[model samples]
Target chain A: MRTHSAIAEPGAIRWTLTAFAVAFLALFVALPVASVFLQAFEHGPGAYLAALTDPEALSAIRLTLVAAALSVPLNTVFGVTAAWLIAKYDFAGRGVLLTLIDLPFAVSPVIAGLIFVLLFGAHGLLGPLLSRHEVRVIFAVPGIVLATTFVTFPFVVREVLPILESQGSDQEEAAVTLGASGLTVFFRVTLPRIKWGLLYGVILCNARAMGEFGAVSVVSGHIRGETNTMPLHVEILYNEYNFVGAFAVASLLALLALATLLAKRLLGDGSHGGQGQPGASQEAR
Target chain B: MSVTVRNLTKRFTASAGSPRAPAVADASFEAPDGAITTLLGPSGSGKTTVLRAIAGLEQPDSGTILLDGVDCTAIPARRRGVGFVFQGYALFAHMSVRDNIAFGLQVRKMPRKEIAERVDELLSLVQLEGLGARYPKQLSGGQQQRVAFARALATRPRVLLLDEPFGALDAQVRVELRSWLQRLHAQTHVTTLLVTHDQEEALELSQHVVLMRAGRIEQVGTPHDLYDHPSTPFVASFIGGATVLRGRVEGTRAAIGPLSVAAPDGALEGAGLQAFVRPHDVRIARATDQSAVSLGKIEKLVRVGGFVKVELRLPSGEAMTVQMAKTELDALGVAEGDRVLVDLLAAKVFVEDYSI
Candidate 1:
């Protein structure tokens, strides 16, 4: 059987448009990312190594890793729970629930940080209670983690929702009929079916959690050794006229983004891996 | 185990202040032990819903599901000990045939050795012995269906439920799988209930047939009983390809478009009725024959495999279909636009005043 091409054969205008897109990506995205590594290594490998292992840089790396480690898994759990509730069952306010899950995506990250500050700041709502309890949330590691979680909240849920919705409830129903408990059905049947999409979501969530800048900056007090995350550390270094040091840390974030892209390619947009076809997996169920 | 359901009813509320008709309204039937009983109907006839309820996949608003004389209506699906095969096979695409078959046993935490042995046994039983290493996508449609059956049978539940198991396959594979299912049922003797909309499939594979219409059990009997002695006009027309003709009954006879046929027993006299006659029961002959009951013109002749379906229009403009052997049709030399006489060999008449 013959299939239609997704786009018609390239005319002069189409070729011109394609060339313009390629040039735009190269100039805006590729060059800037390339310059991060290029400028970081301009002082040679020794300086680059020194800048990476610098005390402040190391602490920022540790703080960023710690924040990502705390936030990604928490958001992943939330994402799966939210997706399961939204996709597997229907109830009143289902549409409203979906829109709420997507609220993080629509809200600006800086605004997300501001909202948290309003709740946890020294004089904001609940601030007095928190202060009375002698526990600090704003301008601390906890605040950084919370802000990062807020910014990356929608990644896993969005990725897993469509896959779960397409999968239907047949496999889970079959598992129940076959005498598998609810947990067993989820771990054995439901998890395996959505593993690729879930992984894709987690990868994106991890990327956002690691690279988050604006939100972490607002909540993180930028106390060098205590609460400075990688993005905040990069700002500190750049403002201190340590250009190579700043680019070196930025290089790591760029590498993380590259790794995420590589993982997405390997997973094939969550559609090609695993069963490769929605109907095929449905048939198996 | 013998499975019986009483007064199974399920209703879906479409939205606030608007309730849709029940999917299965007061459906009750008994599937005998160690026999294949088929719930047969068109889509939305509640056949699949009844099967799902028996499997405990769908909770009934009010019903008692008795399995081997035990009340299991409130039991959850996982504890009901019933194996359900979905219409689309529902195989785990990520698992090989062996692992797929072993899933149920593994879930029950059966010993590894025992799980392997049982998987192998099922693989051989389904005639998919060597293909156990292949993924579901690597196999053909028929192979995947067999794997699904094997997986469902792995746990050896008291009852096996199949919901249009062959509904996804093509014609040739559907026929092959139907016979395969029959053989499997015979060997297992596991008291199976199958749901299908195909009349021929239900007739060919089932020992007992439950005919359903609009969420109600229309009739329940053996395939032969349902086919030969349908209790309702729906059953009579649904079980076989029957042409329903509108007419008025006079005593024991029904007059339809210049022809008269014996009315079904208990049909009211002097009342408008619908006569249900199988296509093959409508005999056709040359119009010149004096023994002919009614005269009509052959509108079209459709050859379907070994038999030809003849479309005829009566003088009163009522359309009727007659099935005849190809050789018999050839011998009669009938063609489109030719006038012919049709004889109603057998018919079942019911009062047409009532709505289904």
Candidate 2:
């Protein structure tokens, strides 16, 4: 509420609060982001290019992209299936299923990494069986992917669940009565309704998959190129006092953050204008 | 399609383990081809459940759903070829009105050109000629409902099931759609099963009404049949404006205070009886009138549109609602607390005191 008295008016306080927020963001967020870019180009574009093109740096980038590539799609599929079942149906263990889906969010990323280690490490629960089959998981690229996937597993389901739960099953039932097959109903009606929230979840899941550190660090043996992802690669460069190389790779991650922000803006205004907002309450699909 | 259900019991799951859930018990009725049969009852009476069972959306625990004399209980909803308009319309929000109507046809892989012609025809038929490009949210509630109607009919299913389709609309809109639905039914002549708690909608829209109460099928008959000759007290009270009274009927001198009715046939002499009287059938007169049957005191007088509603408290302590013209009321010269006589012009009497 706006105060009537001039002595206690918001006119002065609004600007003061806005200035303080801007100053805080600039110092903590914008400054650090700018410094990373500035240091990446500290020795000019040639050095920045050299650092990025270094064989080990190139492999680290490849491994990070591959991990994200494998994990994001896998989680997106799992997330949609999970959200569909959890939101659309009622069963004895539905509450348990929802809580289990949120386990990734509740458990620390390091613990999530440890869970995979306990399952598939050399001395893990399945250690002997995995060795007998001549398969590797922990201390390998697969381990890094698994840890990344676990950390990012809940994003899509958490996002899509609320929208589906609110939208209700009326449309689906109507489609069924209209002679639409199960797959047809999902593709034509259900998917279009939930696509926006699903897309938002995918974006968040992909971002986390690309930038995960603690979980990937626990499982990744930091094999310089095979297992080390971008964050692990950055830590290695920093430990060796290779500031330029570290910041250069770190700038890539910062670039990803900027890209994600851009996507949010674009989707928020553009799709919400043309199509609609994600939520069922907004009547936007 | 002439849809029939035999020995039908409400069951949501096909798994044979638990005893039948007491939702709709032994609700067997036939919805004739080319006619609208309404399952009319209050909410929780399982009217919607019965309609869903017919649509194959719900599995009946111990019954056979016959569509055109073929057992369709095992068939899925899509294969059974039923069209359902949900209470909330359930139009695909993301799709344009055109796409919404075209969805059913497209699902069955109809030719593109034929689908276009069908959509155009439906748009015109539902009286929304140029609103096809608009999404469901952009359309008004009535328009969205019509779109759901047209979409349901687009495939020309064997039977159409409507579950309280006009429930979400305002009273005026519902009345408008009520007549509109009759016109559509007249034109299409589709076999339809409508589920609604609104007795007026059911009576006005359906040729047949299966009145249900507490998940039990009360009676099945035509609208006038159910209204004029309700088989049970529940039916009598549910079908129309009936004020039920408990009275005693003796040899020709019915002992219902404040009103007198000719002892209904077979009402046991000198025994308690349940009587249902319509509001318009009760006539109020001055206490000194010769034909006055019993004494009553006017408890309240309310001026409704085109009529004055008089609430009369009988000597039996039962209140009787009667509607009369203002002129008649003025002639009687009765107000609140005034003693008057009541003559029950018509009533349906039962031998058993069901009101008890």
Candidate 1 regions with alpha-carbon error over 4 angstroms: A1-21, A266-285, B15-17, B264-269, B289-293, B354-356
Q: Candidate 1 chain A: worst 10 consecutive residues by lDDT?
A: A276-285
| Candidate of highest DockQ | 1
- lDDT for each candidate structure: 0.87, 0.87
Model 2: how far residue B136 lies from native, Å: 0.8
Q: Tell how far residue A207 is off in model 2, in angstroms.
A: 0.7
Q: Over the stretch A1-285, how does candidate 2's per-residue lDDT look in tens digits?
A: 644875564668879988999999999999999999999999998999999999999999999899999999999899999999988777778888888888989999999999999999999999899999999999998899899999999999988888889879999999999888889989988887787788889889989999999999999988987888999999999999999999999999889878987886666565664544222335333
Q: What tens digits encode model 1's per-residue C-alpha lDDT throughout B87-189?
A: 9888877777898888889888999999989998998999998988787878898898888889989999899999999998999999988898888988999
A1-285: candidate 1 lDDT, tens digit per residue: 656588865478789989999999999999999999999999999999999999988999999999999998998899899899988777788889888888888988889899989999998998999999988999988899999988999998888888888878888888888888989888988887878778878888999898898888888888988899888999999999999999999998899889988987766644553644442343221
Interface RMSD of each: 3.1, 3.1
